[model samples]
Target: MKEFTFELPTKIYFGTNMTEDVLQKESAQFAGNVLIVTSGRSLITYGYLPKLISIIEHLPGNEKVVVYDKITQNPKLKEAQEAISLGKKEHVQSVVGFGGGSSIDAAKAVAAGIASDENIETFLLNGREPDGNVLPIIAIPTTAGTGSELSKGAILSSPAHHIKAGIRGKKLLPRMAVIDTSYTWTVPERITCETGFDVLAHAVESYVAVKSNAFSEMFSEKAIRIVGENLPKLIRNPGDHAAREQMCFASMIMGSNLANIGTCLPHRIQYAIGACTESSHAAGLIALYPSWIRHEFEVNPRKLNHVFQWLGYDPVNDAAQAEQLFSELKTEWKIPYSLSELGIRESMIEDLADQVTGNLANDRLSEKESIIRSILKESYLFRQ
Candidate 1:
């Protein structure tokens, strides 16, 4: 065991149909005006927005609730800026992220922006660290992936600059997280697959990351087991409430692991792919997994074996077997297994590799650009 420090400041409420009670109990955090940040009108279309607003309005000390529904997929810096502007104008005291990871990430960024009165672009692009003066945030996740609800980081993209990266700080951790499985019941099948795979990615990456410790590994292993078991069930029957609950649980715990140890090369590289193309985050990760896992086998076969065993592959020393199983899983779930499938081009590989930010230290890989280019090229043409 290695020496490490861990902290999870967010109070988590996990279950089905407990959002109201949880909000009522934690209403002090929602005192004064509240801002609700979402990706779009899906919450409104699903009738969740009105219900959430009504609940917040009824909470003790809650004065008003405003909705900022312009958050977009991949959550750009401009969206955070706009939401922060609205929050400031409305005098919102706290923010509630009311959808998937994108909304939750945007909400955190908005809270930080409002509190500091600083443009979030400085943090995302200029390497400015967020001071611990962020407005209180409460995350209400309607998806079972990204685990952004309990995380201490927010991923925002700057399309204008062609850069996507994370803004990380302890202050960015939500003050509270509400995970109601019932809210995830209506997620479309395609999203379900993508986000569920994201859960697996978080677990696997954290478990294998060089920064991982005993505490983080415990949560990572549990999340991996839960994802392997329940993701398949949800794929077969999207309405499996029990499976949904399990996945939500897995997602929540994996979030803690991510906060503690973080992910590996794939997440770092995926940022470049995201910056260059309009690929879903998880799709890029899935495409990069084979090369990543192969690297793990070469550098740390023992750790890779532990991860595969958790996913129910016994005696899995062979990297090819592991890659084959992953390919099969992607095919069954209809997830693309190649970067080209997500519209990434062979010609763009060099630039994509150049756009990659951060170090691969956590992956135990060389930080050389050629290593990264090789991985990208392999994933571009990957086929099982």
Candidate 2:
């Protein structure tokens, strides 16, 4: 047993209708103004905006709330700054992150940015902590994945820098996180699959990260198992609400696990792919994981074996299970089986590898490049 510390600071409000609960319970803490940040028409068309107005209609004077809806697929620093400028202009005292990871991440930047007129790029580049208390942020997650509700780190991309960076600290954690599984009821089936993959990736990478401890791995192990069992079921039968609910729970757990234990090679590689290809983060991860396993299995069999068992693969002579898990990711999940299948160029592999090596993540960078490059090659050449 190794030394470990455990702390979960976010106030989680979870139920079939917890979104409404959060609006009711936490809305009054802020001043007259509120900024609701969201993405896309579906969430808006699906009642997010209407319900929000209803919530504010009940506020003392029934003042209309301010909202910024310009969040993009993968949040960029410029958009986040734009959202912040809008929030400041509205005199918003509260911020609501009302969609997936991108929206929530944008909301985080908005929350901190609303506190100052200082340049947003300074915060993005310097990691300058927001001074004084920030506007209260409530994360209303519509997706079962990303679990940005529970995480303090907000991933924002800087196109000028062409990299993704996290503004991470306990203070940035949302004051309230409302998890309503019902919001996920209408998520596109493809999003359901891809986001669930994100959950699985978070669990697997965090489970094997060097910083992982028993406390975090306990959550990661259960998260890995539930995701392994339920993701395929949900994909095969998209209307299965029970499975979606389980995946939702597992996603939150895995998100917290990642916050504590951090992530490893697969995430490092996935970042570069996302930066290069402008594809879905989960999609990028699926493209690379098989290769990641192939490259790391020899050196990290114990970790692979544990993930295999969590994934419900028995008969694990560790090495065999490593190969078996890769097969499951390919055959069972039916994820984009290769980087090239997703339109990523073969030439992108080595450059992505170099970007990953220079990435300032939790792991050491010096000796990690070869393993990353080999994984990238494996992803390019992997077969069904």
Candidate 3:
């Protein structure tokens, strides 16, 4: 086994109704002012937001709770700035991320900005590091994807610059993470399917990542198996509580895997696609998976075979067969398989490839521009 080190600083509370229990106990450490960052009114419409507020308001030393519900999908840097302004104005001493990955990512940026009192764009766009003055964060995931609650990275988009990227730091990890499976019970079928695909992507990419070690692969393999066995059950019967629990667990562990080893080409490419198009993050990844799998099969067949076996497929020596199996899985889940389906034009492929940023060290392929353009073209015209 290769030498490696791992650490997870976030205190996790996971269960059916562990949300109230965790918040009730943890909120005591919060200051007089708190900020709740969310995507929209879904939490309120579903009563989760109100319940969270009630719990915090009744806790000692929590005199005020502010809600910032303007977060959107693929959260923008400006959104984080706005949220930070709100948090600073309200004197928020702590932050709560109360929804999906987008909400949680925005919350982390807000927390960093509020405490550092600096433009978070420097951290997101440039290579500036946080000064370790970030406010404490509590993460409550409403969906079983992204795993932002347990991650030390925050993905934010800059609309003006036409870039979407991540800010990573140990200080960004939440002080507490509440993983209540009940929150995912109300997720729409499409969202559940897409988010489940996100879990699968995270595991597959991390398992093959150049930085992966024995310890991270342990979590990656288990998460892949769990998502494969449970995602389809949840899709067929959305009321499968057992499957829901398994997926939720899988998502959290995958988050830890992501934090430790990180992802490869698919995630990096998707950031560019997200910056250019209105495609959902999971949709872009699903579209790119066939090409990514084919690449892995060529350069790292042994690792790809492990992933195939965990997904219940017989060992295959052929790259085409490996790609086909993944294609079939997405088809079964009713996900789109081509970038064209997500509004990518043939002319836009080069620009998309050029926009891709961040480390590609985990990918086996050389980070040549021609190679990236070819991959984008293949994903765009795949099966068209």
Candidate 4:
């Protein structure tokens, strides 16, 4: 086994009504102001946000809370900076990331911005390291994908640079994470399917990354198995409480794996696609994964075989079975399987390849620009 080190400091509170218990216990450390960052009407429409506010309102001492609901689908650097400015203005001593990955990512940026003097722009665009003054964050994930609650990395896009970037540091990890499976019960079927795909992608990519170690792969293997067994069941019967809990468990493990070992070519390509198109993150991943598997299967077919078996497929002699499974999953989920269908054209392929080749490192996939271009083109035209 290769030598490796792992540490996850995010305290997790899990169960049906653990949200209130977790928040009450964790918020006591910050006696001053707190900022809640979220997006959309779902949390509010469902009364989760109001419930959280009620909990905060009753906290002992003069604990003030503010809400910033301006986060969008994929977080932008400008918006993160804006949220950080608000946190600073409110004099918030800590932050609560109260939605999906975007809101959580934005909250992390806000936490770093509020605690240090460095410009948020530099951190987003130039990859500047934080000064370790970040405010403590409490993560509450309404969606079971992205696993932002337990991750030390925050993904943000800059329109000016036309790229999606990540800021990573130990300080960026949330102080605590609260997982209540009930919060994910209301996720729409389509979103449920797509986000489930995201969980699988994180597991697969991290498991196969060159930087992966025994510790990361242990979590990745368990997460991969959990998502494989439970995702389709959850999609078929959205009311399966056991499946929901299993997926949440898988997502949490995958988040820790991703932070520890990082992801491979597929995730890097997905980020590049996000920079150019309005495609959902999981959709982009679904569209690209088959090609990625085809390219890498020759390097290590046993790894691919293990993944196929984990996903409940019979042992395959060739990579074609994996591609076929990919198509079947896409059709079953009603996800678009072509980049052209998602408005990413042939013209954008070169730039996408360049962006991905520049940012991501992988031992299996060739980093040659021509090979990367070919992979992107195949992913674009892969209708089957």
Q: How far is candidate 1 from the true structure (C-alpha RMSD, Å)?
A: 1.4
Q: 196-263 in candidate 2: lDDT tens per residue?
A: 88888888777766677888888888888888888888878888888888988988887687667777
RMSD of each: 1.4, 2.4, 1.3, 1.6
Candidate 3 local lDDT, 1-384, one digit each (tens): 889988888999999977767776776756689999998678888999998888888887898989999998888898899999999999999999989999998899899999985689989878566876999999989999898888988888888989888888899999889999999999999999999999999999889888899999999999999998999899899999999999999999988987888899889999999987777789899999887787678888998899988988898879888878888888888785699988889999888888877788778774544767777888985552
Question: Any idea how many clashes model 4 has?
Answer: 0
- Model 2 ranges off by over 4 Å: 60-63, 127-132, 318-321, 357-369
Ranking by TM-score: 3, 1, 4, 2
TM of each candidate vs. truth: 0.97, 0.92, 0.97, 0.96
Q: Which stretches of candidate 4 lie over 4 Å from their true place?
A: 357-359, 367-369
lDDT of 1 by residue, 231-292 (tens): 88988899999999999999999888878888888899999888767778888898998877
Lowest lDDT sum, 10 consecutive residues, model 1, at 362-371
- For residues 1-384, could you state the per-residue lDDT of candidate 4 as single tens digits? 988888889988878768777666765755688889899589999999999878887787536888899888778888888888888898998898998888998889889988888788888777776867899898889888888889988888887889987887889999988888889999998888888888988888887777888888778778878888898798789999889889888888888886787777777777888887777778888888787777677676887788888887787777677677777768876675688877798988887777973336654666544666776898887566
Please report, as a residue range, the 10-residue window in candidate 2 with the lowest summed lDDT. 357-366
lDDT of each: 0.87, 0.76, 0.88, 0.82
lDDT of 2: 0.76
lDDT score of residue 318 within candidate 1:
74
